[model samples]
Target: MSPLQQPGAAGPVFALVPVAFPAYLHHDALVDADREVDRIGAALAHLGASIRHWPLEPESRTEANAKARMQSWASREHDLPHSMLAWIGHGAANQDSGWLAAYDTAATIVRRGISVDTVAGPVSDEWLERSGDEGAWSIVLIQACGAGTFAKRLIANLLGKPRDPQRLILIGVGSEGAAYLGAVGDALEEMLEKGFSDNDDSITLADFAYRLRAYLGRRVGADLVVHEFAPDGGTPLRRSPVVPGGVTAPVNVYHELRAFLERQPPDVRGHFVPKAQGAELSELAWYFVGRSRERGRVAGWLKDTACGMLVVTGGAGSGKSALLGNVVVHSNTRLRDLLVDAGFIVALPDAEQPPPEVFDGVIHLAGMTTADLVRRLAEVAGINPAARAAADLDALVKALSERTLTVLLDAMDEAQEPAVIAGSVLRRIAALPAVRVVVGTRPSVHDPQRRNPVTELLDALGAGPTTSVLWVPRDTEATEEYVRLRLNGARKAGRLRATATAVADAAATVAGNGEFLFARLAVHEILARPRILAPKQAKALAELLGKDQRELFAAAVTRLSAVSATFDPLMEALALSRGRGLPRSDGIWATVATALTSGRAVTEGDIDQLLDAAAPYILLDVEDGQSVYRLSHHNFREHFESRLAASA
Candidate 1:
């Protein structure tokens, strides 16, 4: 079976909220949601998906009830990697915001969710951050009138990052008037059940995301738009059913590429494969605040094979790793354009999921020397490494000339045999055909340190590019920008619960400090909750940054659990979610949390207390109408998971 059709890592999306329209909520769906839900369910079943469904009444549609049901559903083990959550119902959207009308929105009841208004959307602040974990397939699909029009901004607010968070793909319909929601479900089911029956063709969610709009326009005669947001900043990697003027390739190209990549085996241990993930592409796209000129110079030089070799040397903790990572991601994007112009195809193998965009092949060398790196990389290029290992590094690279290689050699000083590897090995490899190398290492700040391995390696290589990164200057500017960026994004996501002035003041304080990690820690702690800070709050946050990285991390954790009783439970759940982020586990955590909270007999009230408190810390997202919760950051999951495991 094609990998696209393989079972999701986190099982299948739970298709909840089976009702088309509740009797209450003072609203109704534009289409028959029940019929639409059933259609998608049958399609999923045909595709061999493992999913769960929730049964609830319209009166039970309060935020609290929905939260509880989602928690119960997620607590079970499906032995899958990732999940998708979809909601098909009536939706309201305006220039300011968008929301799915929940049962709580009845005319007789008060609105529970809203940013500026008394009411808000059911989807939570950490929705994007938590719903998706690394290497899992997660999607949030919403179908409602005006959802298509308001989705771009509304989803940005809900998910925080437009791009797939690690693996989560956020998609929605932006509507003009009435939406043909049922048609969307029908199309998805039809195409999926067919399961790329055409050996020469396969589909990615990206294709689906863009194609949905076309489907609505054609089948329903409804004008609509779709957005496939990526983490490479707020700009969506928007796909259209057709590229207005772009070249069309043979349909078979899709299946051929998918089959080629899927059939390849994972790199064996000892021997290695360059991970397509990392090089901080998406993170850089977002957090990279400055050094546009430097990034351009390096990107341009790398694109030109003549200046294939360059070392970006910097002091420890100066953001060298951060800089190099962004370069590769951006460079690849630039290269993709170049390749497309040259009649070469560049694509994301996992679609929607951002792995390295490859033009032939891209490799990053975090560790490994000239010869060993070449031999191993050759294997990835389908070159028989056993046959080529005996040859010199130059000859081995030449054997793989058909494939273009962008080699990122990060932190070379940390690698074994740094001097020999960087000097002779890297120089020779860089000189080879279709190969470009970018290396990172510690700067030689002192004369005696000139004997530093990197210094010696440069001398040996001779006639190459070397740029020293002034950490303080670069990071200082970037920090302030990052603070502004984060805070702004938080406000958009409806997570920033502080006055604008207060949040700005806190950001200024952190930015002025000029230390990268500490600022991040401070922001994650102070802003993680209400998404903002006040004068006193800003001062407390600034102080919490601590003397160093260690103290800062400790401070961050202290804040995580300081005021919230639900923090520990949420952390445990996040850790247990296996990195797909935690789904709300109303059933699993209630009794366990009650037993742990006080060593005394506890009632359901205690569980309620904890769960209620967790509401703020955990993000609530919906898939197929289930309200799921996830931790705001992976570090929180790691920190709490470690604590839980230790206690156990």
Candidate 2:
């Protein structure tokens, strides 16, 4: 069955990278193979293939260890039953029979040098038996010399003698360069392109083999020969029907990259979500975990205090956003209502991309500017847009003269020259009859002085007690509950489950060490795979991610980066475009990319795929009808942005 025709065809692409053997072989050869595997894995991901590169660690280079690895792979419970395996390394015909180097493979007297064990025939007798099914078609590409020999030996071993034709296809080369087998690599890429272009993963093995042969004949002739072999003779190498096109989702609403980002005018919605930002925010508050102390304190302040400006300051992931989220959208009914009665118009602003800090007293607003904020306020207050647009804040204040408004702003510290925006524009508005302002901000971690933006703002606000400054305290119990709630919610939602005990244990143990943001991320990573029911695996996974938030951020970003070529650039631009996250505009990012690097390193041309490629890391959120790109957390932004700067 052709992959295109299958209703839900799927197969994973796996590559086995040879070990960094002793110095005898060109060290570059093994390293080149590693690079090739990485390159191929990335490309295959673009074709919507699930790609996995298994680097044989130093310890796994023993014959016994190698066999164990192969056995485990063949028996693993990966969701995909069919697979495409690429063996990227050296190959040779030792004596008469051909041999492919194993992880522990070394030279014998007649061979290169004693590395480890050599596989001339069957890797494991039960490998075929243990695999999903006889009907499942598997393709193995021996991207090394003596590829044909490895294919014949392995197939022969699997069959023992000539058995019925089983669905296994092998492609290998007769001879290979010290570097990657470029001739074959070109052909492999071509075949994949064709299969992907056709939206079919089910390109027949026979067709692919012929294409490979044709490609080799045209490219290098006899100097580098390519061969395809299979058990039951190499007549027709059939493979599983469901073998391609596993792109989980389009990058965004519009699958087209240029259309998604580069359009002259941004996509105009048929209708806007009524106070969509707040409504969506309220929805997000359902999972609002932790920050109980902060919430309670802020709530108390809101109830008794008739009018005051509160500046919540801390480092990223200090629960500032969550604290603000609670006050704005998720706090208890009493507190939420109290703030709302005071005409709470949230300026939790996000720009399309970080605009230059040009106009003072107001941060750059790509999709929605401060003027837009006033207009929105006018709408809520039943004031006409014309009335407000004519006079700006004067009109807004006059229109809402009766209302004592409390404006909740988050991420004020992120604004470029945020002190200007917070002190001038926000303070001006707060000075109105009874208008109050509460802003959340992060400390500038780089400055030697460790100056808090809020300190300056407090002084500007007359340095009075009315300007309340407080840290969102860290709560172990609250964080632990947050973790447990997420994991258990996943269980309830059917995304994952463990024994109630297992879930509880993981939450308690991991959450104890887990930062609130990191705990949420860890849970997200854990659930994407098969359910971790085994007590040890569950604990191990939790422990693995419990190291530090920065480490967790790195792991998450790296995990997504490996699969997509677009992640690095998108991330770099985001890192540099610090204050307001990268705008959703294509041209802006493309320009930022050109400006930040010698070459346009950040722009993927197709920003959508790059955005899509960097998933779970480059989170997509629509704020006030504008699409915004941001790292999952500010901590990640700081870390990655620092790395980008260091590289430059």
Candidate 3:
């Protein structure tokens, strides 16, 4: 079979609503429930051609009368055709407290119909067993308070029948006594829509039941219980259709990449393989590999070698660093894995660093200097340059061409601003042929024209408007997992102690920044910060932050101010005119928040002319453009206006 054949159990939906006792609550029932009824009816009508309606009401409330009435109804419906289906609504009574359509009545209905499907509150197990022989599928929903125990019994009984396979599917919420048939009906209706197959008369009914329950649990809560009873069911009970992943740690990067890879068949030859090192690098690599696998669904370039490079880039804390780290830890290659095995591996020239020869077939990290990098690349290739007047760039290119090597230059911006490095050494590295070079950096640090070494490499790698860039976003669960692992390690080794929950909570509270998560200094801060601050103080600080406005506006102002001092005062003037500052104040009422969050201060003159210049970041009323000025996010304003520091 082709690896991409769509799974058979892809789309199925079902709902079962059996209102056994309709009389008592009839008054409270929606009088004009036409909208709900029509909506549900229409959805079911699409299920199949057969539709049956059975209103089995006892003639009287007496014990004898109820028994006879149910027997008669059961007998009549027992002969229903194979394709026949029906809906039942009736006045129901507690199985123990009162008599429902009795055993005889049920027997009669089962005789008439080949399969009698009953959806009601928990009925007597004895009564259900008697009707079980006639190809019956009972979808019972116990909708009473505290009905969990009763529902369990009913589910057990229904599952034990002689005709277990295709004979029954039970679903309920709360206890069996407290179960509501309306919910079961809703699930059945949904399943029928998504799961029905016209080609197969015998469907995989249990699979449908399991998938439906999972779907409902996600939409609501997991307390809703659903049971599928089949002696030879296609899927065993232990093997659920859905596989829940680790909620606390980052998801298995291996699994994610594998899933994507499985979706797109890989070419056995000429594929560009990336080797990563460190926790940060592997995490970043996961992002690229995962996306390549996904893109393989639409295009096959990811599995081909025609592409020279696959650049992974994104914002800080977005998961780029983690992805890179995962790539290296799991890699079979020593060079890639050794660097990233610890989550983040920083490589630079050192006395103990491996000689250039050892990096011949692997990625080599050298000093930030272009000359050193170029020299290392040449040495790794073992290409001896002839003695010449000047060491030409061609000498390095020739060595790289002699062998296939993939160079990973992580954190290019960490060395220096891109502008200074972009033109010379970076350009030279990008110009090399028969070699693959990968770089990771933030979008903010990349400006092509001036000196963005990263962009220069990307442009050389053929990145363009139409080309897709690989990105990794933070995974909260993964962060939690990482925290838990770290905390456990510290506790086992007798570090000053705390519970895992407390540690996890603190770890999760930290901002989702890649640099902070992977850096040794950052990890130390994460571990020490909680110990440094009192729990009460931390809680208070978090609460205060919840109310505070964002500081982006102030930061933006700061960025602009770095270019020209006038920018801060301009924004302040706008806030003052808008009433954030009083005209009577000497200094622009520093309370204007936007100016502060961006670390920018507003001047009195800024308030005077705020309306004209800060239009993009500040909203201006067209009718009275100078009447009010407000920052986009409250945090921005608060940062500029308030003197309080982040408590946490």
Candidate 4:
């Protein structure tokens, strides 16, 4: 079999081909040409690359010799998955084309010692276009003057070819820019070291380009140009000799989790309450307070050697997800302090003991299947998700056995198959050695005639010594604090025309039942119409305060009906979306809205106005570079669907 079809290859293979010319016939010689080549070659070799330097002898640096050597190297390494070509020498460019000066390049070529001929021995842009395989990832690094012009011509050439799956990246200095010898090499080495220390298995070319540009800008204040063709995400340059443990630090995965959560809408993730739209996961830390006792319980669970799993059960919107999100986003120091304060692990001198283990993996189960969960876990664990062996659950469990880590799985009740996830998936994962599992979900309801999914899940887990359940109760104080904070901000912003005493009274009454979801909706209603705070509207405020989540949603819909004629159709469209929200771009929202409204000629402007009127009930987010809209809460969708059913 060919190398491209080779089975069981561990990772991508990298090949480095460098060529440098120090002496030119008519141009000034480069004294550090060989040194520049050596520096770059060393950096690439550190990443496990096979290096091939052209022109073994200084006398053979002519254009004919260089072309032959490059052609031979390409013939041998064409099937390799990744290759980089580095050119360090003088470059000349005109308006339309560019060329690299070879050792024998001259202003005028003299043939037979008498006849003056055209310039010869200069490698033109066409030579580059004819070299290298288009099927493999090809990276070109040019460190010569006018390299940017050469890169532009090469980019234009490749743009005319048929696009391939692999990418071609050209990183070069500006057209008239000059680069100091060893600068590129030093920057690359530093970037690799930092990435490895952070537990990155591979460095993407995009990231490398950014780092290189920043480094050069700070050091020499020069602009580095980069051109990419047939781009397919970020192409990673694999590190040589993988880390021995095959385990990623929890902090790295925590960073990934934070990024994942930020990309999701606040309501879908249940990490944010109402009126805090567009708040990132990092900002949620400010709103996280009064969960000390629950955090202590979690810490104790983590410290317990015998307990393998801790299930956190609470009613809807009782702060289960927010607590978990807080834990995931905490800094290393803060997480360590939480464990030390909870008495789970004692603080010691930095030299005396290593820091305690924080959460290593966190996955939200909404819309995730068994395969999706497995893939996510494998990725966070530093395992190759595409490997055939990773597809099997047992194989994955064995792979994870090599590392000691804790993972948090949130919103189990929201999963596509909650029973399979909680029973089979979580059970197997929790059974692994040195692995701790934390799960968050709603309380199980008992059903005599039908099989209760949560009950079955709990039964599957059993009341074993390794299993523990922590019930989440209403936090009246925390709810009150949240209310006070939000209302005070509204009052300051002139959105609420209530006095300090009135605000305090409203906070107390709203948080009296300790229902966080209800309080959030109630505050939203009050803010929507500040006139409700008037003396004559006391009964209206009292009525609003007395309503539950369903009643509040119904009232909001009634108010929306007075605001927009398309409110019912809009709610129906969002309800029909379920987990996969509707994109607001490319006429998708218009098409769906028009269809739902029985061909009422819905326009983009109408959709925008309706969305504005129904902002509280809507969750707007960006998915795959497009704006998406969904009902803010699953309960809200259920209410809409139930209303539709009753009317039917």
Every candidate's lDDT: 0.46, 0.49, 0.37, 0.59
The segments of candidate 3 whose C-alpha lies over 4 angstroms from its true place after superposition are 1-303, 317-322, 333-367, 385-391, 416-433, 444-468, 511-523, 529-534, 537-648
Order the numbered candidates by lDDT, best leading. Answer: 4, 2, 1, 3
Rank candidates by TM-score, best first.
4, 2, 1, 3
Could you tell which candidate, 2 or 3, scores higher by TM-score?
Answer: 2
| Residue-level lDDT tens digits of model 3 in 1-648 | 111211233322222232233322221232222233333444443432122322444222223433333444333343421221122222122333211222223422222211222322223332344344454343333333323333455555545655333444554444322224345446545444322211112333454454555445544354465665541333221111111110111222322333333433233101213221222223323223222232232122222332244456655434444454333333334433333453434442232132222112333221134544555456445556541223445667655556666554554443333434444544445445555544454544433224534544345335443334565454555555555555555667665256666565655654343323232223333343445324655664354223211333343465456655666655554433422322112122334433545666443333333322332344221110111223322223344544333532
**Per-residue C-alpha lDDT of model 2 across residues 281-387, encoded as one tens digit per residue:** 21144356555556666666666566667777765555666656545443233323333344432222222111121111211221234555566456545567577
Best by lDDT: 4
Cα shift from native, residue 179, model 3 (Å): 88
lDDT (Cα, tens digit) per residue for candidate 4, span 102-202 = 67766532221111011111122322443454444566677666666666666565555454223656777645536455667776665444323212334
For candidate 3, report its TM-score. Answer: 0.32
Runs in model 1 lying further than 4 Å from the true structure: 1-287, 303-308, 332-376, 379-382, 385-405, 411-428, 431-434, 441-473, 559-648
TM-score of each: 0.41, 0.46, 0.32, 0.53
lDDT tens per residue, model 1, 1-648: 221332222333333323233444566423355566666655554333444554665566655565554343343233444344555555566666655555556442212232222111333322333454433344455565655644566555545534424333455554645656667665654344221222212234454444444334445543354545442222111111111111111122222222333443322111111133232121323345666555655555554443256667654445666566555544455433433453433332321212234223333332334565556456555677565566466666566455566656655653446667766666766666666666666543123223543446455544634322222233566777777777776777787777667666667777766455455556556655573365546455556643454455545546546765654554465446543332222233344444455444333233334434433234322221222334433334445655667888
| Number of the candidate with higher lDDT, 1 or 4 | 4
Model 4 alpha-carbon drift over 4 Å, by segment: 1-283, 305-307, 331-357, 388-391, 445-457, 566-568, 584-590, 601-629
lDDT of 4 at 343: 48
Clashing pairs counted in every model: 31, 14, 109, 0
